[model samples]
Target: MASAQDAGRGWSMAGRCLTALVGGYAAAAGLATLLARLLPVARVEATAWGMILSFLFYAAFGLWAFHEPRLARVAGVIWGIAIVTGGAALLLGVRP
Candidate 1:
């Protein structure tokens, strides 16, 4: 029988995992798209660079999500970056 404390801990961990995976992916994709659009190079090369950097972005976001103590802060920062970068890329006419 799981106590309330244990249940809360489980939920918290679940939230952190989801934020680190899904939210982190979103943030990485958004940043990659922005980079692809903004790099001053040939289209193919720019896109390649973005693709290469996306892995680092994901890893960084995942690490930060786990390192943060507050779930709300983690969610807000990760999702906020995802939305802002995605929106900027869209506005800049970068096709995802």
Candidate 2:
């Protein structure tokens, strides 16, 4: 029973780390692609700005993942943002 509890705790920590890394990256990339396509500036300038802003997004998501009380909720929010931004980028034909 004690071992089972420890295993569950370990799995929870691993899940949080995975969400912070993978989910954060996906969300940031999707946001960057959407912004790059939608920005009114020249393509080169917009893309550069988007890329710069994405770092902030990634950092914020990483922080939120650890701070949030529920790992599942954090994962859900990250995935939701990723899906919406990704779909919008696709619809806008953003290539990156």
Query: How does each model score on lDDT?
Result: 0.93, 0.89
Best by lDDT: 1
Clash-forming residue pairs, model 1: none
**Candidate 2 local lDDT, 1-96, one digit each (tens):** 225648887788888889889999999999988898889889899999999999999999999999998878998999889999999988877454
Candidate 1, 1-96: lDDT as tens digits:
336767888888889999999999999999998999999999999999999999999999999999999999999999999999999998889443
Worst 10 residues of 1 by lDDT: 1-10
Please give the lDDT score at residue 19 for candidate 1: 94
TM-score of 2: 0.86
lDDT of 2 at 78: 93
